[model samples]
Each structure stands twice: as structure tokens, then as C-alpha cells.
Target: MLGPLQVRGKDGPLRVPPGRQEVILAALLLEANRVVGTNYLVDLIWEDNPPETARTQVQICVSRLRKLLAGADSTVSISTRPPGYVLHVDTGDVDSLLFTGLVAMARRQRDEGETEKAVALLKSAVALWQGDSLTGLVSGPLANKAHQLDEERLSAVELRMQLELELGRHDRLVGELQLLTHENPLRERLRGQLMCALYWSGRQAEALEAFRTGRRILDQELG
Candidate 1:
């Protein structure tokens, strides 16, 4: 559920029903195991101007999703509870959850002075991202959630590169860091890391220039 509204079963990928149904499933999966309230889901599906039949539409969407899951032979289940529903699936089954666990493990490894292991784990974690979270389905609450997840992904990348720099792999990291800083000019952490990588790579002038560029951007945009 990280990249798209994909629901894989024992056989293969299950075709998710279109429109509000997909939104409902995404909302449930995002809060998997926790019962999401009916009102909350209604807001997610229609933003602010839901129709009078919005609650009934939500119920119908849930019902369709359940049948789709059953048809696909998915281990995942949606159970109705007071106020709303809960998506029952293993945490590991969700890509974002798995990525988060890997990132946590990587951080632990890095804290333990195991730079190589940390780098490897972070690489695996970052690779799970096929694209932006919930791509092509941005609406309402999920859009904000997706943006938050993307920030986490960028942070993880920055952490991984920081570990690489600590290993004196500055020469190899300079190119990547430069591009990342260019893509996210306002990201102070990435800019700082890029400056460090350039300095350690024996490009002192380039490092100073990077700092100047970042400072200018910060002053211009933030002030």
C-alpha cells in the first residue's frame, strides 16, 4: 500500500475497486489494526462536502472491499467495529511498516558503531519505495499523510548518506548529495551533509559555495 492501492493475494495482485472504495481501503490500511471511525473515513473520502448518503456509501465501499479481498484469497481482512472498521493484516505485510522497521533497525545498528550494517539496512529500507506514497490517489487526509511519509523517506536517505560519510566514502557520496541538495534546496540537513561531503572530498571551494547557496536560499525563502 506504499506506492499504490495494491492488494496482493496468494495467487497474485488483486484488482482494487476504483474510486471511493480505493480511498476507503487506503484509509483503513494506513490505520491498520486500529479501528478508524466512520466520520473520519467519510471525511477522507469526500474531503469537506460529503453528501447526505456519505455514511451509507462508506458502508457499501467496505462491503465491496471485503468481497474483493475474499475473491483474491487475501489473508488481509476488514472487520467492522463500533464507529467504523479495522484492517486486519500483518504489519510486515504493509510496505511502509516494513520500511519503518528496517529504518529503526538501521538506526540501532548505526548507534552500535556498525556503519556497514546500517548502510545495508538503510539501502534495503529505501529500496522499498516504488514511488511517492499513495501515488495517483491524493485526496483529503491521505494527501497529508503521504507528504509526511515522503519526508520520512527523505530523512532516511539523509541518514544513510550520513553513515556513508562517516565511513569516509565522501568521494562517492558527493555526486548524490549534490543532486539531493539541488532537488531539496531548503533541506538544511542535506545541504549540511553535502557541504561536509564536498569538504572531505578535497573540494573546499565547492563546499563553501554549497553553504553560501543554502544560506541564501534559507534567507530568501524563510525570511
Candidate 2:
């Protein structure tokens, strides 16, 4: 659900066969324990041009997934219910769902003036990401969802930075902000944050340069 799609068995990581099986499993995992219609999957995988055998092909993919999962931990599974299928697992079993839960809890903590606790929870949430969301599967139906997840991660990061800055931890934040701003140069909010961190840490020249760099990039690329 986060980064690459992986299944854990009693031993260790289970290898999911590549191709449609990977996509089907990803779709089912996205809607764990909820029915995902067969037609929707056909449209998602084939993308507006599906052969007549699409449904059968989907069924075959599901069968292969089931066989692969047979060796996986019992807590995860797939079940057919008419027009669709369901992937059964605890909410905590899914990294993305767990990340969402942590972020929500952190937001509640932040709203209640528990800024330290909020930052801690946000750290946990951010640590769940191994890399960009759905890195290999984003070209298909999961594109929008993957983008949304990435946005959620970014928001969590920014919120944590704000809280830490407010707590007067700007010294510790400068290095992190540098890396984030480097990775996401086009994100103006992150750039602003990096500038603030640099200024607060007494690197006033660097702060001004950060601002200048952003202005230059916006003028040259977006103008």
C-alpha cells in the first residue's frame, strides 16, 4: 500500500508475481475488506479499451493472487462476493491506513495543544513511507489515489515542521528542511519553511538565497 507492493508471509516477504496480479492485488488492498466491483477493475486495468476476455483474465489474476497468498499470513486474504472481491485484514496491517490513523491522531493532539505529542505521532506517520506512494503502479487507475497519498505525506511533514518551529527547535529543523526543500523545490510552502528555518538558525544569507532561488525557478519555469 506504500512504496512497493509486498506481501508478508510467516517466514518473511512473499513475492507477488508481476503483471495483472500485482495490479489486482494493489486494487484489492486499496479497498481492503470492501467489495471492488469486477467492472470497475476491468476499466481500471484496461483503461477504456478492454477486450471481451478482460473479466476472465481478471478472474485468472485473482486466482493467481489467491494461490500466492496461500503461503502468506492468515490475517490477509481475498474473498469473492458476486460482482467483486474483498481483501480481509486489520486496518493496522496496511501501512497507508496506519499512516492515516496516526496522522489523524496527531491532528487531534495538535488541536488540543499537545504539540510535542503531535510531532511524535507525525514522525511515526512519516516513517511509514518507504518512498513515493505506489511508485510502480501509479501509471494506471491508482494515479489519483497515489497523488493524494503523496499530498497527505507532504501536509503531515509541513505540519510537523510548523509545530517544531513553534517549539523553538529551528536548529534541529534546518537540516531536515534542507533535504525536503531540495527534493521538492517546486513546492513553495516547503521552500518558505526552509527559509524560515534557515533564518531562525542564524543563517540569514542562506535564508535570503532560498527565497531568491524560489523566485528564480518560478519566473523561469512557471512564467
Candidate 3:
């Protein structure tokens, strides 16, 4: 579930029934293969104060989600345990998990000085993101989780560009780096990489300008 909440069967894209059921399914998917306690599920759905019927409503949501999954012929199954529910799904089926694994592999390749391989791996990892993670479901505790995943994605992109720069592809990276720095002005690593790219491309004046812009942004934002 990288972008919007999606469940696909062997045939095609499976339609996730809307409303609270969607939220319940998302919460379960986030912690697939583990039991998410009933209380935690309640908090995820209703936040601080849930109504007297919150537990019942949660059960209803889970039942509906199970039906939807079964109807879609999905291999995943939700098991009712003592405390709550567990969504049984393969790790490979989740885009976020695949992305994380790819990033980890890329990091290892980068450490081994395999710049080309690392760049390719990172490119594939970043491509898994269709849009903002958990879109339309970013509320409650999931907001922070989404933000963390987004930061990871940005780091992967920065690392990929850094590898490209190391391979003397600085000239080709200038435009992309410029846009990245503009989008994440306060990210020192990206700014530093941008400066290096600009300098290597013989754009010395622009490199100095980039540093100045970063320093000014840091002072304005942090001071």
C-alpha cells in the first residue's frame, strides 16, 4: 500500500470498500502478519474518544473488510486472535516493504563502491512511490508514519543523485538537483550535493549562490 490503499488479486485491481472499512483495512495492512490489539485499532479509528459502540463498530468493520477481501479472491486473510486481528500477507506483496528492501540493498552496494548498481537499485526503489504514501488515510498516528516514509524516499533520491555525481554525471544532475533543493531547501545533505554538482559542472558562481541560499534558509528557518 504505497500510494492510495490498494488491494489487487490475481485478476486485477481489487476494489476496497470505502469508509471506515478502508481505514480498518489500512491499519491492518500497516501491521500485516502481526496482531494489532483491539484497543489500538479503536484508537486508530476514533482517536482519543470513541463512542460506547466503538468496539462493536470495529468488529463490524473487520467483518466487512474480510468479506471484501474474500470477494476479491485475495490470498490475504484476517485471523481473529485473542486481543484483536492479524492480517496474513506475504511481505513481498507490499510495495513499501519491497521499496525498503531495495533501499537497503542500494545502501550496501553504495558502501561497496558499486555506484552504478546502487543508482539503478535506488531508481527502482523510488519508482514504487506512486504518490504520497497512505494517501487519503493520513490522520491520527498514521500521519507521522507517512512523514517518516516520505523522508526515507527523499533520502533514497538524494543518495541516487550522489552516486550519479560520483560517476561524473554532475552536468546531467544540475537541473534535477536544483529542483530538489528548491523543494527541500532546508535539507543540508541535498544542498551540499547540489553545490558539489554545480561546482563539478563548472558553474562556480551558481555553486556559491546555492551555498548562500542554503545558509540564508537555515538562518531564517532555524534561528
Candidate 4:
């Protein structure tokens, strides 16, 4: 039932259990930060021509999910609206949502010449992602959201590294950046960051080597 469902972690690979309840929660979270109407929820979960108990079923699912979230975090809320329900989860509480906020804030701070704050914020955001976005969730709108959030998070890291180089933190970032670039060989920006870090670390030849390798990988993979 929804009572045993977990968000992303805090139990055995947090996930909304498989069934109509999971379907309902997915629909709500898809539009997290906004309201979803009763009719629309019915349509999403049951598609065309729901049974006579459709309304009752939706109410039950929402109520159960609300209870599960309550057990996890009291602030995680699903509130009533005239037409339906609103999921009012803070963007900061979820890794993907928080990652987006941090990236945006870091960019603004960087633009304002607040490098230290920008680096700190960006690092915190990137650190929240232990692995791929939505580690346990299957493909869906939520999966797409997780992927986009991850891309934004990576961009934030690149931006922070640029500022770090400006602040001469290359020696500190070089090893980690090397591993990052190796893991994401297809990411030219990450490779570029590693190159720049090497260059700023006073390893001009190695920096050039990094650039060459990046270019070769790009040519081979992307042509």
C-alpha cells in the first residue's frame, strides 16, 4: 500500500509501490509545485472510462500517499484544492529539485562576483547526487526530470570549476576532475575543465595532452 512507499531513500530503494497508488503519486509529483484536478487525476490513473468507484479510489490513494509522506517528513504536503489536490513539496528537500535551485543560485552569485559563495553552493548541490538521477525510479516524466536536473547539476559544477581556477584551486580539483572526465569521457565541458585545471596547476604539457585526448574522443564518438 502507499503507507509502505518511500520517496527515494530512507528504506530499501525508495519507490512508490507498483499499482494504482503509485500511478496517482507519479501524476501528482509530475506536476509538483502545482495543483492537479480531480478529473485530471482520474484521467491520468484510469485513462478513459473509469469504474463507478473511480472517485473513491482516487481519494483513497491520495490519502494513503499523504500518510506515507507524513511518516517520512511532516512538511511533505498534499493539500486540497477546489478541483483537486496540490503537492507542496519544497524544491530544496528533493535532490533533483534542490540541485536545480543550487545551480541557479550559484550562477547568480557567480555573476555578482561572489566566487566563494558560488563554489560552496555548487559543491553542496553536486554532492547531493550519489549516483544517476532518480536512482531507483523507472522511466517516466519523473525520469526525464531527473535527467534534466543532472545536466543542470553538471553545468553548475563546470561553472564552479571555472571560478575555482580563477581563484587558483586547480591543485585541489585536478585529481577529482581527472577522474570525473575519465568517467564522463563524452562530456567535452568536463574534459575542458580538467584541461584548464591542469593548465592552471602549471602542467602545460599535460593540459595539452588532456585536450588532445578529449578531442580524439569527441571525433571518434561524435564524428
Best by TM-score: 2
lDDT of 1 at 55: 97
Model 4 lDDT vs. the true structure?
Answer: 0.74
- Give a tens-digit lDDT track for model 1, residues 21-89: 888888888888999999998898888898999999999999999998988889999999998999999
Clashes of each: 0, 0, 0, 0
**How high is the CA lDDT of each candidate model?**
0.90, 0.87, 0.88, 0.74
Off by over 4 Å in 1: none
For model 2, name the residue pairs that clash: none
What ordering of candidates by TM-score runs from best to worst? 2, 3, 1, 4
For lDDT, the strongest prediction is 1
Model 3 misplaced stretches (Cα beyond 4 Å): none
Superposition error at 38 for model 4 (Å): 5.8
Superior by lDDT: candidate 3 or candidate 4: 3
Worst 10 residues of 4 by lDDT: 1-10
Candidate 3 per-residue lDDT over residues 26-115, each given as its tens digit: 888888899989888788778988999999999998998888789878998899997999999999998888999999999999899888
Task: Name model 2 segments beyond 4 Å from true.
Answer: none
Q: TM-score for all predictions?
A: 0.92, 0.96, 0.93, 0.75
